[model samples]
Target: MLLVYFLLWVIFNGSFTLEICVFGLVIAGVLLGFSCRFMDYSLAKERKIYRHIFGFCGYCVLLVKEIVKANFGAMHLILTQREEIEPVLVTFHSDLKTQVGKVLLANAITLTPGTITVTLEDSEYRVHCLDRDLAEGLNESEFARYIRKLEEEKQVRKG
Candidate 1:
């Protein structure tokens, strides 16, 4: 955090001198102290955030891949199986513990091409799928897996 603050100070100042560097160091230290004292910020929390950054990036990549795959699947269903399409409503319970995890799962489902989350109440999710095939394995999806991993990481930290 101090390093980040110092970098920001240097970037904003546009020029660096010995005097400026000393002042920037002092300012960054003061800001870091203030954050630690009053804002509940700590090095441990910063490290945890840094660790989650890679996991979040991986989840984002998986989301984009799923979106593209779903788009093709939906397109195929619409073009070739329109008359035989079997739309379904799927209700499933998830084991994710955090509200944020549940919400993330719900939003990820809704973001997919052939599925939309109709309701998310407690641990239960009701999803409307464009076809039965899309509804299959709605509960134990990769999105849910990623979210569960995130939830577990938090739990591990707490324990």
Candidate 2:
């Protein structure tokens, strides 16, 4: 995981020789210093991050589909004779067992049009939607379920 993090850091930072050397020393020092804290605590964080990046690949495809659908839905509503719009706020519990997972869920909600995650308390997320149909779709199922599964799979793989 540290290697992956360092590689990603190097890639993003242009992989400069000086920067890589500097980052290598810094990362080594930090890992050694914090080794006690991570001992027996598991590599959940590493797994979560690894899966999170891969998760984005799937999400990118899903996002395109969702965005197109949302655009058409919004377009239909606007072009058709819809006078009284029923905006709604939907509250639901997230299945994400970690803070990182919760954040991912919130970001997913906000990225999709007509839906915004207003707040997340512990595991509960309060999301605002543009209409009842949108609210209904979200309330019926927590999207975090998918994220949770991915995170879980990551943890298992690390084992």
Candidate 3:
């Protein structure tokens, strides 16, 4: 994790001077210390990261599709049926077992135009939607299921 952080620092800084490298090392060390205390180290192992890399990429592609669909849905609703906008607050339990997966799910929901993740507690997410249909769709999202599968895949490999 420290190595990755250092590499990212180098990339962002666009420098390889001795002083910059030393500074990056210090910063990376501090960040890594905090990450070690708060993050699941098992999930950050190099082998595990490589193992799930392809699947994670695939998930991102699917997420883009969902985002586009949500945007068009919201546009259609706004243009054609403004009066049918029945704002709803929906809460549902997420099946994703990893912190990373849960956070990704929450961010994805918020990125969609018609929905926003209000709060996440444990495995439950509360979302505010522009309409009842959007809320219902969020409650039954395939993206959530895919994220849950990703979490389970990691656990299975770790075990």
C-alpha TM-scores of all predictions? 0.74, 0.62, 0.69
Candidate 2, after superposition: displacement of residue 119 in Å?
A: 1.0
Those runs of model 3 whose alpha carbons end farther than 4 Å from true positions after fitting are: 1-44
Ranking by TM-score: 1, 3, 2
RMSD of 3: 5.4
Candidate 1 regions with alpha-carbon error over 4 angstroms: 1-40
Which of the predicted structures, 1 or 2, would earn the higher lDDT when compared with the native? 1
lDDT scores of the candidates, listed in order: 0.92, 0.72, 0.85
Residues 1-159 of candidate 3 have per-residue lDDT tens digits of 778999999999997999889999999998888886787564357566788889999899988999899999999989995655799999898767788888999999999899999999998999999988888757558788888788777788879
Pairing residues by index, what is the TM-score of model 1?
A: 0.74
lDDT of 2 by residue, 39-115 (tens): 64336656656756777777666667777787788777667888877888888876667787678778877877778
58-105: candidate 1 lDDT, tens digit per residue? 888999999999999989998893568888998999999889889989
In model 1, state the lDDT of residue 140. Answer: 86
Clashing pairs in 3: none
